[model samples]
Target: DCSLAAEQLKNSPRHKAYLEGVSLRQLQKLYSLLKGHLGGESLAESLENDKELAKRKSIMDELFEKNRKKKDDPDFIYDIEVEFPQDEQLESCGWDAESGEEI
Candidate 1:
C-alpha cells in the first residue's frame, strides 16, 4: 500500500510539488504507521493479497529497531491506524518520493 502510494505520488505533479513541504520526522512517523498497518504481517489478513503492496515493502527497516526501543509499551499491539493519520487521508495526500512515505 505504501509502495503504491509512493508510486502514485511519483506520478503526480501535485505530490511531487508538495514533497518539499514536509519534515523528516513527519515522514518517518507516517512510514512507521503505514508499515504497521498495511504491512505484510499486519492483522488485516487480506492485505497480503496485494501484490503491489507486498512487492514494495518498507524501506525504513532501520526505523524498526529504534521504534521498538521507543515503544511506550513493548507488549502493546500498537494499532497504528488509530494512532495517527487515517489511511484514506494519507493515501490522498501521498508521501515523500525519496522514502515513499510521509515526511
Candidate 2:
C-alpha cells in the first residue's frame, strides 16, 4: 500500500522537490515516529499480510544485524599503507643492494 502510494506520488511533478529535499535520516525518523504512534501490534499483523514487504524487511534486518556484528568485531582492522616504494626507489633497512642480505 505504501509502495502503491509512492508510485502515485512519482507521477506528480510537484512532488519531486518535496521528496528530494527529505534526507534519509529524516525519512527514517518519520517512519519511526509514525510506527511508534500507530502501535506495534497492528503493524506486525498488517506487515504479515504483505509478503513482498515482509521479505524485503527480513533481508534488511539480516543485513543490519551483520553490519552491527562487523562493527562490534574486535579483530577487524582497517590499515592503509599508502606510500609503498618502488623497487628502484627502495631504501635498505638491513639488506645490501648487491647481496640483498643483512648488513
Candidate 3:
C-alpha cells in the first residue's frame, strides 16, 4: 500500500514537483516517524503506548510550521544567525571549570 501510494505520487506532476522540494533529511525523518507509528501496532494503540513520541511529534510539527521557508521566497536567507539575550548570571558547570592541566 505504501509503495503503491508512493508510485502514484511519483506519477503525478503536482506531487513530483512537491517531492522535489523535499530534502532527503526530511524524508528520512518522515520515514522514521512512520516506522514508529506503524511498528506492529494500531495507530491509537501506538499513540497510547508512547505519549512522549506524540508530544515530540507535535513539538516538531509546531517548530516546522514556525520556521518553514519557501525556496523562492525573497526574504529567505541561507544562513541565519539569532542571538538570545541573557537576563540572568551565567552558571558554571563541572565540565566547564578550570581543568588546571595544560594539554
Candidate 4:
C-alpha cells in the first residue's frame, strides 16, 4: 500500500508542485515518515471467522449486561466490526517494490 501510495503521489502534479525540487528518493522518505503516523492495521487472524466473532460478541454482551446494572444510561450501545485484508492488498502494502519483500 505504501509503495502504491508513493507511486501515485509521485505521479501527481499537485504533489510534485508542492514539493518543488524534491528528489524521488526524498519523496519516498517523506512517504515512509507520514505512513508511520497513520496507525497500524487492526487484525487478529483468530477473530476473522464468524464463529470467533460471535463468541466475542457474546462475551461483550455479558460484560455490558453486568455494567448496565451499575449505570443508568439506556441510550448507550456498542458495536464491533472486523475486516480481513485481501491478498492483493497485503502484497501492495506489505511488499516493498524496491526491496521486493515484506517490509
lDDT of 2 at 47: 46
For each of the candidates, give the backbone clash count: 3, 0, 0, 2
Question: Please, what are the lDDT tens digits per residue for candidate 4 over residues 1-103?
Answer: 6567676787888777776676666666556555544545223332244356689999999999876733356665456377877665443554454674664
Q: How many Å off is the CA of 67 in candidate 3? A: 2.9
Tens digits of per-residue lDDT for model 3, 23-88 = 555555455447657677556664564587778899999999888897788888888899987997
Where is model 3 more than 4 Å wrong at Cα? 1-47, 55-59, 82-89, 93-103
Superior by TM-score: candidate 3 or candidate 4: 4
**In the order shown, what is each candidate's alpha-carbon RMSD?**
19.6, 19.3, 14.1, 18.4
**Best prediction by TM-score:** 4
Name the best candidate (by lDDT): 3
lDDT of each: 0.55, 0.59, 0.69, 0.62
Candidate 4 wrong stretches, greater than 4 Å:
40-103
Stretches of candidate 1 off by over 4 Å are 1-14, 40-103
Summarize candidate 2's per-residue lDDT along 1-103 as a digit string, tens digits. Answer: 3443454454458776677766555555445445645775465554454566778999999999877635458976666368755667655774454674542
Against the true structure, candidate 1 reaches a TM-score of 0.25
Quick one: RMSD of model 2? 19.3
List the candidates' TM-scores in order: 0.25, 0.25, 0.28, 0.31
